[model samples]
Target chain A: MTDGQETIKSSIWFEEAEADNPYAAASCYCSGYDVYGDLLGKVSWVQYLYLLFKLDLPDPQHARLLETLAVALANPGIRDHSVRAAMNAGVAGSTKASALMAAVAVGAGNLGGGREVYLCLDLWHHLGSDMEKWQHAISQPSQDERIDVWLPMEHFPGFDPNGVTCPRPVVQTLALLADIGSYQPLIWLRDHRSELEAATGYPLSMAGVAAAAFHALGFSSEQAEMLYLLLRLPGAAAHALEQEQHGWRQYPFFGTALKPMADADYQSLMKTTEAK
Target chain B: MMESTRNSLAYFDNHWPTNKGAWFPGEAVRYREMSLFDDFRDKSWMDLLIYGIRGTMPQPEVSRLMEQIWIICTSYPDPRLWNNRVAALAGTTRSTGALALGVATAVSEASIYGRRPDIIGCEFLISTCDQVAAGGELDVIVMEYLKKHRSIPGFGRPIISRDERIEPLLAVARELELDRGDHLALVKRIEDVLDRKRMRMKANISSYCAALLADLGFSPREFYNTVLLSFTGGIMPCYLDAVEKPEGVFFPLSCSKIQYQGAGIRRLENVKK
Candidate 1:
C-alpha cells in the first residue's frame, strides 16, 4: 500500500485496536473487527462495536474520548490547553487521556504548525525578490511592466497577518516559520497563490501557511489539504458553539444605530497596552 | 449724433451694463425683523437621555438573547430544528450596530447545517471567503468615502421609500414570534431620520438583512462574516455573468476625444542678438 494509504489505514486500525483492547486486555485475539469496513457501502454499528471490542476499550467511553480528542485537536487554543492538560495527565498517570493529549499536541504543534512554516519558507525562497534589485528597479523611474509594486515592502511579498488583508493566522505563522528554515511548502504556495488571490481579492497567506504546515509535517499536497480541512473543523464548531451560547440574534436596531467610535479612554488604554 | 443700432448692440454686449442706474428711494433703508425660535439646547441632554434609553435597551438585550438562541439552535441534535433555527436566526431582528453579531449567528447557523468532520471540504468556504473579501472591500471603500466626504454611503438613499428586504424578514420574525418590538422601533426611527433628511436616501437591504441575523443571536464579528457569506452566493453568479458577457472583456472603457483650439505655431521662435 502507498505510504499515505498505509498511514490512514494503520491509524484507523490502531484507533480501533486501542478501543477494543483498552489496557491491552485482548491483544492476543480478536478478528473480523475493522473500523473502516465496506469500502463502497455503509459501515454498520455492529462493525463499530466489534472494532471497539477488539481494541479492548469500553465502547461508549472510547467513542467519547475520540470525540473529545477530535474537538481539542481542531482548535488551536483548545489544543494548547490540551497539551498542558496532557502533560499534567501524563504526570498524574492518566495514561489514556495523556496519550490522547500527546497525539493531539503533536498533531497540532509539530505537524500542523511545522507544515505551515515550511510552506511560507518555500514561497519566500522561490518568489521573493531581492531587496537591492527591487530598490534599484524602483529608483530607475522607468515605467517597466515587470516591476512588482509590493516587492520592496519590509515584510514578505504577499503575507499579511492582520485580518485587514486575509486575517488567517496560518499565513503569518508560515511566513515566520519560513524565516527560520522550516520545510519547503513554497511549491504549492507559488502555484496556488495567484488563484487564491484572484478568487478572494486578498493575498493567499492562509493557503501558504497551510502548505508550509503540511510540508513541515511531511504531508504531501493532497494529505496537506486533508489536514487543513481537519484542522479547520473545530474552529468552525467552536464559532458555532460560541454563537449558540451567546444567544445573539440579528441586531434589532441595524441601520438605525450610528457607527460607534472608540472612546478616547479606550484608545488610551490600547496605547498603554501597546506600550507595555 | 444717433449711433448705429448694430454698433449700440455690440457696445451693450461688450460692456454688459455696469451698475450705473439709480436705486429706488427706500432701497438703502435696511429693515430688521425678529422671530421667536425654540432652542432645545437646554433640554438637549434630556432629549438625548430619553432617546438613548429608548434605543439602547432592546438591541443589546436582544443580541445577548440571540447568542443563547444560536447555541440552542446549533446544539440541538434534530436536523429539522437546526434548519428551522437557522431560518429563524436569518429572519430575526437586530440592533443597528449589530452587523458583526448578526453575521456570527448566521455563520454558526450555516455551520451547524453544513457540519462535517472537516471545514475545508465545506462548499461554503469559497463563498465565505468571497463574501468576506467583498464586504471588507466595501467597508474599506465606505470608510474611505466617509473620511473624504464626511458622510456614510449606502446607508440612506432617497429613491428607496422603505428597505423592501427588511419587511419579509421582519414578517418571518413576527410569524416566529421573535419580534422584540425594539427592531421595529429602530426601523421607524431610521425612517423618521430619512424623512427629516428629505435627501431620499433610505436604508439598503444589507443593513436589515444583517440586523435580522444579529437579532437571532450572532456576535458582531460573526454578523460581518455572515454578510460576507450571504453575498458570496450572489457574487459567484454575478462574477460568472460578468465573465460570460457578450463582450470579451468584463468591463470596457470608452475613450473621449477633445478638440484643442490653439495657435498653429509648430516650433518655438528664439530671438537672437
Candidate 2:
C-alpha cells in the first residue's frame, strides 16, 4: 500500500511457543492420515503417496491402479543399473540405508529411473488439451522445419532406439480398459497408435502411459522422478542385502585383464609378497 | 544433446584400439536353431543362476517360468488386481512395481505348504515319507497349508476358478524327463487331497517351480531367491510396452471415475471469509 508496493502476508506455516502449548498446524500433514483427518493406514502406500503429493486421495480403484504400477516398478535384480549401484555399495560394506541411497542416486539418472517419464509428462503439459498439436509435432516433419520451428526431436523422449512397437499384451489390456473408462489423453494416444508407431519406428512406450497416469493421478512433473526412486527403494534394499551376503573383494575395474609380464617383471612384483 | 553425443563419440574415438590384440569373430550370440535343453546344458547350474538372475544370460527354464508369470500377470490387468490397477492408474508402460510386488509376494510364500509355513528344503523332498520335517506332515501338508494360510503358494489364483498353468507345465516337466522328482509326487498328492475336499485347487506354476528347484538341489532360501528373479523376465516387456508410448498417453482415465468416499466438499469456515 505504501509507494505502490504491497506488503506480503502468509498463513501456511507458524512457529508456536504459546502459553497453552498448542501444536502448530501445517497446510499439509501426516501421521496415519492426511491434513483433513483421513485415515492413512486404511489406504495403500500408493494411495498415501497420492494424498501426500496432491493433498487429496484418489478413489479406491485409482489407488489400486497406482499400487499395481508401483509394484511393477520394483525389481531387485541386477538388470537395473540403480540396483547394481546399490549392490556395489552394499558389497563395499556400506549400511543398508546408505546402499539404498546409492541405488536411488543412480535412479535419478536418465537410464535407470523416471527421467524419461517426467520428460514425457512435461511434453503433455506443454501441449495441454491440444491433441492436434501433438500429432503435428510428432509426425514426420521437413528438414527445414525441424531446424527452424520447435518441432519434436528425431527421437521422441520415451521411444526406444532398438526399433519401436507396442507390446501386444499392453495394447490389448489398454483397449479393454478403454472400453470401461474414457479419458481424452488415452483416447488420443490409442487412436494414433499406428501413426505414432510408423513415424517414430517405435511403439508407444509404458512411459507414455506412466506420464498420462501421473497426470491423471494429480502428480506434478517433478513427482514422476521422485516416485521412480520411491518405488525402486525396497527392491534396491533387497539387492543390497543380497550383495552383502554374496562374495566381494576390492579391486579396480578389469584388474584381472592385464597380462602378466616376463620373469624379471614378475619377480620384481612378487618381491614385496616374498618379503612379507 | 548434440554436444553430449559429440563428446561421447569423441571420447570413444580417442579410446579406440587401446590394445593391439588380433580380432576373432566368435559364434553368433543368438541361438535361433539351437535346442533350449542343449543351450542350458552348455552352462552349469551356478552359471545359470549367476547369469539368469544377477547376470545377463538367461536360462531356458528361467525364461519359460518368467514368461508364464508374465502371461498370468497380463491376463487380468483390470482395476481388480492391485498390481495391474496401479500400473494402469500410474500410466506406467511396464507395471514395474506391480511386477515386483507380484514376484516378491509370490516368492515370499514358497515356504508354505499347509498353514505350518514349511520351508521347501532339500531334505523335505529327498528324505523318508514318514519323516515330518519342518512340522509339515507328508499326507496332511495340504490340509495344514489350508488351515494355516487359508491358501497355498503354488495353488489357487484370483479371478480364475482353475489355474491353467498346472497341466502345461507338468507336461513340459514330463517331456523333459523331470517329472520323477519326489517333490512332484508330493504336489500331486496334495492336489489329489484338495480334489477330494472339493476345493479343486490344482498345483500352480509356483508349486511346479518349487519341485523343479528342489530337484535341481537349490536350498529353500535359494529357491525363494531364484523364483523371485525367474519371474522378472515377463515384466520387462510390459514395462517396455508402457515406456515406448508418448508421455501421458497410457490407460488414461478421468478423476470422476475414481470413487471418492472421503471428506466431502467443505469450506474452511473458520478461516476469515
Candidate 3:
C-alpha cells in the first residue's frame, strides 16, 4: 500500500523498466529469481519450475522427484479421454489452440483426471499418513463444506472405479518416485497400497500416484492440478497431430456400438408417449 | 471389478454398447426409438433438442415457453460476460467457430454462476417441494437449507441485488399460460423468506427459471441437458463481431497496464554457473 490504500499487483512476476522506454522490461524476475541472468542455463526446468511456483529453488532430490513425476505424467496415451478429445478436434480440423483446449476441458474431471489428483492431494494434506483417517474419509468422504462447485466424490477420488487390477505402470511409477522423497504420504501410500485398494475396492490410478508425489514435493492441490494439466498436454498435442494426419476415415469409429431401435420398439415408444 | 460389475452400463468386454440411437447414411438416423427423417423432419429445432433430452414431445405451450426462455436470455451479447469473454478472445485469435463456441459454452458451466447454480436452484426447489409435500414445514425447510449451504442459489445475485430478467420471463410464462406451477408458487414463498431474511436480496433468473422448469416436471439432469447451449445464441454475436475486427483488437492490454509488485532483480554472483 502506497498510503494505506492497497494497489492491486501481481506477486508472481515483474519486469525491470528499460532505460529508454518505461513500458518495456529490460530484465524479468519470477518469484525473485532473475530469469535470464541467474537461472536460464544454470537451472534445470524442473528446478526453475519449482522456484517459479514455490518461490525457492528445489534441492537436487526434490528436483529429481519432480522431473520423474513430470516425465511419467507427460503422456497419458492415445486411449486417454483428454488425448482423445484433442485427437477428435485435430481430426476434424479444429485450431491448434482448440486441440489443447479440448484436452484441458476433458482432463478437468473428477475421474482419473486433474481434479482427482487435486482432491487426492487435499486428502494427503488433510489426513497425512494416517491409515485410520484415510479409511474413514474414503468410506464417507467427509461432506464438502460448500455445495456449489464439485460434485460429491461418487467413488473415492484418485482411485479408478473401472480398473480391474492395479496397472503395471502405476505400480512401476509408484516404486520409482516413492523411494526418492521422504514425503510421508507417498511412502505411506506406497506401503499401504493394499489397504487403500481394499478400502476403496479399486486400484490406484496414475492420478493417485502423481497426487501423492506432487504433495510430497510441497505443491498445493491447485498447483498440482495446474502442473498436471500442462504436463499432460505434450502427449495430447502429438496424438492430435497424428490423428489429423490420419484423417477421420482412418479414425476409429464406435458406430457399431450403437444398436438401432427396432420398428416394434419405435411403435411402442410413440404409443407410450401418446398415452402419457 | 466386482463392485463395478454391479454398476456396469458402460463396460469393457470388447464391446462399446449404446442405447442412444445412431445413423445409417442414406437411410435414416435413429434417436432412441424415433426416426429422425420419418418422425422428426417436421419438428422444430427446439422440439428436437427437448425430445432428444426428455425422450418425449412436450405440450405446445411447454415447447413455446422453453424457446422463449432461451430467447429471453439471448438478448445479452455483451462480450464482458465471464463466458462471452472467452468467445471474444477466441474470435480475436481467429479460432474456428466450433472451438470458439465450444470453449465458451464449456466455460459457461461455471460453479458460482451459469449452469451449476441453475441446476442447484432447480434441485433446491424440487427437493423443497417434495419435503413440503411430505409434511415438512416450509420455513424449517428453507432455514435448514440456508444453515447447511450458507447461501441460497436463486435467491440472490452478484453486482446487482434484483434480477431484471424475472419480470420479462414471468410475463412470457403468463402469456403462454405456463406460469402456474406448484414449484413456482413455492419458489415465490421461499423468496418472501429470503427478502425478509437476507436484507432484500431478491431472487434472480436462475431460481425463477428453475422453479418454472421444476414446475413443468423437468428432472435436474434433463434441465441441464436441454439448456447446455443456452448461452450460445448470445456468445455467437460477440464472437462474430470480434472476428470482423483487426486481430487482437477485442481487448488489448499493454505492459504498463500491469502492476508489477514482485521482487526486484538480484545479481547472479552467488550462483555456481
Candidate 4:
C-alpha cells in the first residue's frame, strides 16, 4: 500500500460545520466566502453556480453568457432521447429522482448529448481556432486511448450527425450568445458557422453550441460535461412529471415487431445450434 | 411538426426504416406484419421480450432455461445491495413503481457488477476463445487481457470475495442439462489459471451466466440488452417495503456523519461586489 495518499473523499468548495444539533449545519462557507452570512440572496443563481463549480466569482457578462446557456439547456423537449427516457419512466409512475437518473443515463452519451459536450470541450482545448486543425480533427478525432474516457467522438461531438441542416433554433442561439458576450470561441463559431457546416455536412446542434459556451466560460471538459447533464435535467424533469400526469395512453409508444417461432422451426434451429 | 430525413431535407421521415409494425390506437395494429389484437394475444411476455431481442423466438427448452435462470439468479430482495438500495430508497420515499424499478434497473448496469460485467465477461470469453482457436497460449492471452482491462469483470466481487450465487446457478444449469458447454469449461480453466497465478479471482455469478449464455448463442450486445430487467425482482421488494414506511426516514444520516476534512472557516471577501 502507498503511504501519504489520503483514502477518503473530501469536499473542495465547502467547509461545513455542524450546529449544536448534529442534524443542522451551523456555519457553511464556500470558497472562503461565508455562504449564509454574506452570500445568500446577494448573488443570482447563475453566478452562484459559476462560483460553486469554478471556485471563483463570475463577471456580469460571463454570468449572462452562462445564464443564457442554462436557459437554452433547460429543456430539450419530449422528442429528445434523454427527456423521452425520463418520460418513459414518469408515465409509468416512476419517482422524480428515477426520471432524473434515466435522463442522466440517456443524456450521458456522445451523440447529441452531454458526453458530447465533454469531448467537444476537449477537442476545443486541443484545436483552438485553426480551421485546418478543425477539419482534420473532425474527420479523425485524436485517438483517446484511456479506458475511462468515452468512446471516440461519435460524429464530431457538437454537430448533429442525423441533422439535415443547421437548425433555426441553433442558428438563433449562436447569434444571441454571440451578441450577448465576447467569448472568442462563440465569435469564431459565429463567423465560420456556415463554412464548418459545409465542411462536415453535419448541422450545428444545441450540444455543439453548449460545448462552445461552456468552453468560453473557462470550465474544464469534465466540469462542462457535468454542467451539460445538470442543465438538461430541468427539461427531463418537467417532461417526465408532465408525462406522468398525461399517463401512458397519451405518451408515444413504439411497439416491437415480434416474430414467434413455430415448434418445428424452433426444433430445426436447436438442431443447427447443437451442431455448432 | 418539424421534420427531416437523415442528412437530407424532407418534410417528414421515419428514422427507423426496419420498424415493421406500430400501434394505431383505435384501428387495427400490426406487429411483425401480423394483427396485434387478433393473433398472439394470450402469449406470455417472455415470448414478446425474447422475440423483440433476437427477432425470433428460441426453442421452448431455451426459454425454460432462461426463465429458471432468471428465477434462481438475481432475485435478491435485500435493500443493502447498491442497486436495490436505490429501489428501497425510492420505495421508502413513496416513489412510483416505474421510477423505483426503472432507476434501480438503470443503475444495475454497473461496470463492476450486474449487466455490464455480464456482457463484458461474455465478450471476454468469446475473444479468448478466438485467440485460443488461433493457437495462443491460455495463460498468456489471459494475462494480456488483464493488463488492458485491469480487473476481470464477473470475477472477484467487491464485497465478499467468495460469491454465494455461483453454486445455485450451476445447480439449476445442471438440472436443465445445459451445463457442458465448451465456453463454460474454458472459463473454469481460466479461473484455475488465475488461481495458479496467486490471484484470488473466482468465477462469480455473472461469469457463470456469461459462459452459459455464450453457449446459448447470444451476442455480447444482445446479452447486454437482455439483462436490463435482471435486478427488477430484487429491487421491487425493496421499493415496495420502503414505500410502506414513513416519509424521508430511510437511513437519515445526520450532519455529524460527515467529517469536514477541508479548509475550514475562511473570511468572506472578493465576492464580485
Residue A50 displacement (Å), model 3: 2.8
Candidate 1 vs candidate 2: which has greater TM-score? Answer: 2
TM-score against truth, every candidate: 0.25, 0.39, 0.89, 0.80
**Candidate 3 residues B1-273, lDDT tens each?**
546643573564445444567655445567766778788766788888888889788887788888878878544898978789888998999887888889888888886678888878788888889999999988888888888877777777766776778899999999988889899888788878876676465778888788888888898767777888889888999898899999888866545555776666555444321
Better of 1 and 3 by DockQ: 3
Candidate 4: residue pairs that collide = A94-B99, A95-B99, B91-B242, B91-B243, B92-B242
Query: Compared with the true structure, what per-residue lDDT tens digits does model 1 show for residues B1-273?
Result: 113423554554423321111111322211111001222234333232322333222333343333332332223322123333322232232111123223333344232122220121111222222444566443343334345545322245333445454555555556556666433334344445445656454545434433444345433334433223322232233333433445333222111111222222122122111
- Docking quality class, candidate 4: incorrect
Question: Which digits, one per residue and each the tens of the lDDT, describe model 2 over residues B61-98?
Answer: 64454344334423433332443333433335443454
Q: Could you tell me the lDDT of residue A141 within candidate 3?
A: 76
Alpha-carbon shift of residue A195 in model 4 (angstroms):
4.7
Q: Which ten residues in a row have the lowest lDDT in candidate 4 chain B?
A: B9-18
Task: Give candidate 1's error at residue A210 in angstroms.
Answer: 11
What interface RMSD does every candidate have?
A: 39.6, 22.8, 5.7, 8.6
Higher-lDDT candidate of 2 and 4: 4
Those runs of model 3 whose alpha carbons end farther than 4 Å from true positions after fitting are: A1-8, A16-27, A36-38, A141-152, A261-276, B1-11, B267-273
- Which segments of candidate 2 are over 4 A away from where they belong? A1-40, A128-132, A139-154, A163-180, A249-276, B1-273
Residue A127, candidate 3: Cα error in Å is: 2.2
Q: Give the lDDT of residue A43 in candidate 3.
A: 80
